[model samples]
Target chain A: MVVNASQDDPEKARRFREAALPYLDDAYTLARYLLRDAADAEDAVQECYLRAYKHFDSYRGPAMKPWLFAILRNVCRAEYARRKTAPTAVEELPEGGDQTPMWNEAPETPEKQMLRRFDGDTVRRLVAALAEPFRETFVLREIQNLSYREIADVAAVPVGTVMSRLARARAMLRSAWLAEQEQAK
Target chain B: MTCEEAEVLIHALIDGELDAGHAREVEVHIEGCAHCAVLMKEYQEIRQAIAESDLRYKAPLELRRKIEKALPQPQPQAAPSRRSVLRGFAMGSAVSAMAATGLVAIVLRNDDEQRIENEVVSAHLRSLQAGHLIDVVSTDQHTVKPWFNGKLDVSPPVIDLTAQGFTLIGGRLDYVNAREIGAVVYKRRQHVINLFVAQTANTERKTAKVSTLQGFNIRRWSDRGLNYWAVSDLGADELSEFGDKFESAMRANKEG
Candidate 1:
């Protein structure tokens, strides 16, 4: 391996640590959501940090959160590919069709129904069941609280796409919740 | 705005992503339309539920510790500025003070091995970066070994292991730890290995010590009053095999 001279700079490393270390929790959270396992999340986070440290000089952004999260997301995707256990792609349901008609069927008491659907495990399963694009956008927006612009920057999508994905993701989660509720009954 | 249009903007409104005019428009529509109002409330509840739940997983303490421990130690930058040279001169007196306090000897003894290891690795890396891995390129050990004559006080043993898959490429003169040393370059397939040898007065031969630095494998041992360090990006098993072949060939040459 030919070692590049620029990589030996200690000042660069110190700067990288200072800029990137604070995002460890954010990285791990995204990784857990993406990879869906604690140990795999930890491993991906560690690999992400190492890769980030190596190319830190190339990070010319104003904020490091989106940059670090982007790398963590890539690492998780690669890990998912390696494991070959990515959630199988479900066929896209027709937009506002009979398959998910329950979305429009108003519960008699909206607040009570919303509380019943918010059970932690069910919410987690619903989010995890989303396809990769929607799942990533939802996790970034709702869970990580990134703005649409920030989500666009991290996911390398347009802001319009981020908005659409978030909208579709929420719709899917609502449909899944309704379906799961029907199964329970 | 139609109810369908308001539906598209409901999530954006709840997320604060809409501009004021559009947001006010959506608010007005939702207030008058009971269906849009209920859908908006549902989106708000979903977002709030996610925010209030224990969804964000905190990285475990042990994972944090492992990551922190594995972080690479920063390599000390070698600055050749005039100010640093003057600082070094001033530090000579500080060294004497440390010696007077009986701390210099132990520090120097430990530092010597570490400094040499770092120097050898740096030299190996520099040669690769400079694209000058050899002073004289030759596959035959006889031609390569003769090239070092009269240039150094001691000649490093050169051997050909073409039969064993490690083909001797050439030899070069490299400086490590302020002393001239011999770097014998070899190849196993595509991986290049640098074998650094220098004459030393310490005659105690020891078994090879293996270490890794920055993803490179390093093997060091002393034999017959010469110190040998083999550094490469090759696998440990292949490097150890190269070491064994080199050592045995050197011993055989000495006996003959």
Candidate 2:
């Protein structure tokens, strides 16, 4: 397909690369979360760049991060479908009482306890364990720091859905952490 | 606002996504109700935990280099030739542009093949580095082949060559170029070999061609519309022998 050929001028290619390359790290982070492998994420980001370059003229938005991420998300979905593997399932949350104290009531402080309980690896695993919809929203909001509107635009969902997904994702992570703490005990 | 309404607004408040009026309502509700207050506190804690977690993964340098190499370089427009003029008359400017695009695509596809080779080597190295060489460990070809049935768009022929020194280890779903492909593992004595298989639009059969990257050997060929890339730390002769055995076995399986 001759996508955006009218704007295929040399200057446009240069401009596109300059604008889109800055978000390479952002794209890689999102792809890694979605694809769940370093090699796959890298490949996804590479393809995202090529596809973005082809469709650069269609990008009329002010920010490049979300636009680039939208393409990356599509690329990831295609890759996911090609793989045909079932979505990585999240383990069931632990049962019983809320042994862990709420943020305001904890005696040791939330920051200290969180640092002790959840390391980088733990956090990544927990986030990766989330289902696709919740995982995408959580990564965009929490990690990429995109606004609700931008996330909705990239995910092709409503702002309200983004808010709820983020909420559910956080709740799931909190409960998973409680489960991990319980198991550790 | 009731606690139920307040609970819905709590996430927006933590995310700084709430409007002034709604924020005020949620704040008032939290102040009045201890239960909602604790939920708010927990939400804040979860957000903080994520913020504090070191989860951002940077793209590796090698991958960056590969991407840079693979990006299409702008070609200098040349003067119109006789072929272009004749074709323009026969078709039009749009057709000529499409022809140009097709040529560029061909060049890009060739470059993509080279990039895919680099990726195969990188994947092999990563598997060894992470000690995740195989996802489904087994010696039985029946078990290994079924594992990829649903995982990949195409089922790669899995065969056991233990009698020939190459033993079936397992298979994994690997991403190369832009598509997911099946990568079956094999063991040659202590050396590990990865046989990557992907479906291709090209129908012609190709003889195996050997190349080396970072001291590792890679042999690639296409047969029955399936592209196969075998990579390993084994010697060139031994790896080629493994490839020969694999190809012949696949051919025999097809015939039978």
Candidate 3:
């Protein structure tokens, strides 16, 4: 079996590998959220990394995560755009109580909080309930600890927008979470 | 002092975006202002919850590995002979140009800055690999500064940027230009600027040049034996401004 010319450049290949390593989980997470399907998310991530590697020379900074994320975000957008007309209903808890306000619950001890963990299904539903922008901001800021500026850079928005979206995202998440408990009742 | 102002700034304060003076003011207000304080705590708690939530699903490890394996490589045929390397270079340049224009169009037409920002992100990664990342790690500048005394013949001045909307998150010993260097880490809106500092041997750190390599903006300058390279995915103007502010602060502390 012969390796192709594209696979021969180990340095470039390693650069891509290393750069994509730390951020693979993150990229996948973002893609999963955007596509709402594991396979599509995986595909999106794979495509995004390839797109990123080809254009890696255009990147000139110390951090690779945000840049890779930016690429992943673009790939997700492209995928989403193609499937724009698909009849995917935003998931909603039946007989909803506006939004999940469980986020308003007072901060509890970390251990107690773990005991109160929502099931995977509930968490999925709650994330699904959020508007795309809010969901994306929430994931990048809350899940990834990306700076508002970095989120803004990745989302291609102003930092102010990142904050607002995050706030709204939290608000929506809180409502969705509360709705989950209500449904469980 | 007002509740409205406090609310807008509360998240900023928690994120450490406020100046020291403003932070102090916010801290003082939070002690007396019940409603504003509650709101602040709520936001923080909400942020914490979101961070902990499994709201965003993790991509399977196998998928991640497969993606890594599929990354593209540069064409070797383009760089085969030294004499033909120039021709290869010309073709490569043209290809890159076309790719650049197409990419910019894709990114801009998508009305998303995230993809365009990756250009800066690549530069940020390059700096991380240039040498060891930092020169200090102690919470106190005093400890960090003294540690570099003998390691570097001319010590690069170290001052905390925490007060000026840049929190001195940490520091590490780094290598640049075949010499031991200092890298001070700071966070601005969560974007980490790994500020690489080394004594210029003798040159003043005044002339600032912002260069974008692989999309990362590197603001390089020399001031009072300290050569500073503020590398981040941050835009040119912001990095340049940050370099200016940092240089001034370093200079002022020296005079004081």
CAPRI-style docking class of model 3 based on DockQ: incorrect
List the candidates ranked by DockQ, beginning with the highest: 2, 1, 3
lDDT of 2 by residue, A89-113 (tens): 3333343212222232222223333
Error of 2 at B134 (Å): 30
* lDDT of candidate 1 over A88-169, digit per residue (tens): 6334434433223233544434443553445677778788888767788899988888899999989887897787677777
List TM-score per model, in order.
0.52, 0.52, 0.48
Report the C-alpha displacement of residue A74, candidate 2, in angstroms.
0.9
Q: Which ranges in model 1 have alpha carbons more than 4 Å from their true place?
A: A1-8, A85-114, A117-119, A178-185, B74-256
Question: What docking grade applies to model 2?
Answer: acceptable
Per-residue lDDT value at B54 in model 1: 59
Q: Is candidate 1 or candidate 3 better by lDDT?
A: 1
Cand. 3 Cα-lDDT: 0.61
User: Candidate 3 lDDT, tens digit per residue, B125-164?
Assistant: 6335423234355556787778767654545566777677
Residue B19 displacement (Å), model 2: 0.9
- After superposing candidate 2 on the true structure, give the runs of residues whose Cα lies further than 4 Å from its correct spot: A1-9, A85-117, B74-256
Writing each residue's lDDT as its tens digit, candidate 3 over A47-150 gives 88778878876778637888888888988878766675567644433432323333343232211122235755666667766767777877776667788888
